[model samples]
Target: MPVTARHLIIQGRVQGVFYRNWAVALARDLSLSGWVRNRRDASVEMWVEGAAEAIEQFIAQAHEGPPAARVLRVIAQPVETEGFVGFEKRPTA
Candidate 1:
């Protein structure tokens, strides 16, 4: 499977909703490596690197978030993988 990287910005009802933690669990389940953090602008940002299919699946799950999240939009773009070691929740940026 070919590896791919993507930067995703999830908007709306994300912060304070355990969205980052949810992402960490999902990413780990998918065996993806990267990080997720809360943006100052009230969005959740993530950089995920993994098999293309897995990344796609991650994105799909991200849209629903932790049941408390009311995801408004998810913007994803291709990025260069930094060979991240594991999925993690990062401090807000």
Candidate 2:
């Protein structure tokens, strides 16, 4: 079944990388709804709502990130629902 999930990706060497944009592309391709952003601590965060399988695939991709990114870890948790219109790159927070 489809569900919502929040993922905090500790992207090693993620700064100056296009991790957020890559996440947006993957999310949109998976038909997921949510947003992705970079953290001040050099991590990438995202929330996705869609099929369980799709979300899982997205999470796996996050672990590998972009070609320039070296993902260290991924923390995933379920959410109540999708709280965004579409996949987007949000401002750092």
Candidate 3:
């Protein structure tokens, strides 16, 4: 399977909802490598690198986000893989 990467910026009711933590857990469960963090603009940003199929699934899940997250938009863009290790939750930026 070809390794792929994507950068996602999810907006709308994402902050203070454990979105980053939830994303970290989901990424780990999907066996992905990357990091998720909260943006100062009240959005969640993530870089996910893994199998293409898994990435697709992750994107789908990210669209819905956690129960408290009212995901209004998910902006995804293809990116170069950075050879990340385990999934992690990063401090807000």
Assess each prediction's global lDDT (C-alpha) against the native: 0.95, 0.79, 0.93
Residue 75 displacement in candidate 2 (angstroms): 0.8
TM-score for each of the candidates = 0.97, 0.88, 0.97
CA shift of 11, model 3, Å = 0.2
Q: Which regions of candidate 2 deviate over 4 angstroms? A: none
The TM-score, computed over Cα atoms with residue i paired to residue i, of candidate 1 is 0.97
lDDT measured at residue 13 in model 1 versus the true structure, 0 to 100: 97
User: Any residue pairs clashing in model 1, and if so which?
Assistant: none
| Residue 85 of model 1, lDDT score | 94
Put down candidate 3 lDDT per residue, 10-55, tens digits, no spaces: 9999998888889998999999999998888988899999999999
User: RMSD for each model, in Å, please?
Assistant: 0.6, 1.5, 0.6
Cα displacement (angstroms), candidate 1, residue 74, comes to 0.2
Off by over 4 Å in 3: none
What's the lDDT for residue 81 in model 2? 80
Better of 2 and 3 by lDDT: 3
The model with the greatest lDDT is: 1
